[model samples]
Target: MITALSHPFFLHALLAGTAIALASGLVGYFLVLRAQTFTGDTLGHVAFTGAMAALAGGYDLRLGLFAATIGVALLLGALGRRGRPDDVVIGTLFSWILGLGTFFLTLYTTHRSSTQGNAGITVLFGSIYGLDATQTTTAVLIAAGITTAVLLLARPLLFASLDEAVAAARGVPATALGLGFLALAGACAAEVTQAVGSLLLLGLLAAPAGTAIRLTDRPYRALGLSAALAVLDLWAGLALSAQVPVLPPSFSIMAVTATCYAAAHLVGP
Candidate 1:
């Protein structure tokens, strides 16, 4: 494993994974608190659609993923009058994006001459080992930006998330904070797509946060524990993947995260 660390791809994956874990931990705490797990899952589908669309249009897949997810995040925020987004609106968007993803998949498969039939699979499951230096840098920068934004909004966002009516009555911009947090969540989703892929992203985003919440009632401590667990998940997954080359890193990561969550649940609060 030490020898593998010398490899550029391994190094990139480590850095990128760490950044993603940190961002996911922070954003996910609020995602769980806001009960927006479904929203995060929907964003994964949107990310898949965007990446497919980019491939079909001969653009960078990352661009498509970021643009589509962030746009949807902002739209959801705007449609939401209060901190709580309208479930009906989210349902509508969810169906539309899934349909769009199907269309893009068909378009990509038909027009593309590339023999890589697994391209779509890669988008769905991720190809973290394939991340180049530029992609790693991009993921790290985006993660940093998302983390900083979450920190800046932490206090009010917490107030808004814990009690929307009370926070609004107390003059907190609950609506605005909700929107901003969703936007950050979107960005975090995009960043994580590089590490675990879209399909398995929810595990990475929610598991650590879920475990942390079960273990502690203190918000800051929960956030810290979430980040630490996420980092451990990624590192363990990577190490296991290295030891067993047949396993996909994304699957390994998700498996580790899921196992940890199960263990946490078993232990109880």
Candidate 2:
């Protein structure tokens, strides 16, 4: 264990995974609070399509990832009532995004797969263990930005999420807040996509938040607990995978997350 901790790759995964988990926890709290888990799910697919498009276009994957998710998020906000997307909007975008993902996947496989075969797989299942020092730093920075943004928005977002009607009546910028929150969720989705992959990103976002919500009635306490649990799950999963060579990090992290969530339900009222 100590020897594994000394390895540069493991260190990179630790740093990057911690950042991703923290941001996912913070942003995810409101996602569950707002009943916007479907939006997060949609953004996950959006991230995959975006990365594939970027790879096919020979550009940075981050560009496509951030752009596609954030853009669609804003669109959902704009089209939905009170900036909260309805089932129709989410379902519509979800289908379209999946189709676009297939198109980009085909393009990528035919034209760009020779140059970068595992890139697509990495976006699907993540490459946290493969992150270099620079990638780790970038992940940390992005996650920090997301954490800060979520913290700043927490108060108003909570108000809007819990009671948009009363919040708006009380002069809260519910529409704008909804737009901003969705964008942040989009960013969080994109960031987690790099750490846990687009396929499993929703689990990283939803599970910790859900567990915290189940465990506590207090919103603020639940928020903090969600972040703590997310970090713990990520760290434990990483450590478990480090110890067990055959276990994939993503699977390990989510396994811990699911277990925590199940325990919370069993314990909570």
**What ranges in model 1 sit over 4 Å off?**
82-89
- Backbone clash total, candidate 1: 0
Off by over 4 Å in 2: 82-85
TM-score of each: 0.95, 0.96
lDDT of 1 at 117: 58
Each model's lDDT comes to 0.89, 0.91
Clashing pairs in 2: none
TM-score of 2: 0.96
The TM-score measured for candidate 1 stands at 0.95
Per-residue CA lDDT of model 2 for 47-143, tens digit only, reads 9999999988989998999998999888888888655457886898789888988898889888865765677788989878888898889889999
Per-residue C-alpha lDDT of model 1 across residues 65-95, encoded as one tens digit per residue: 9998898888887777655556677888888
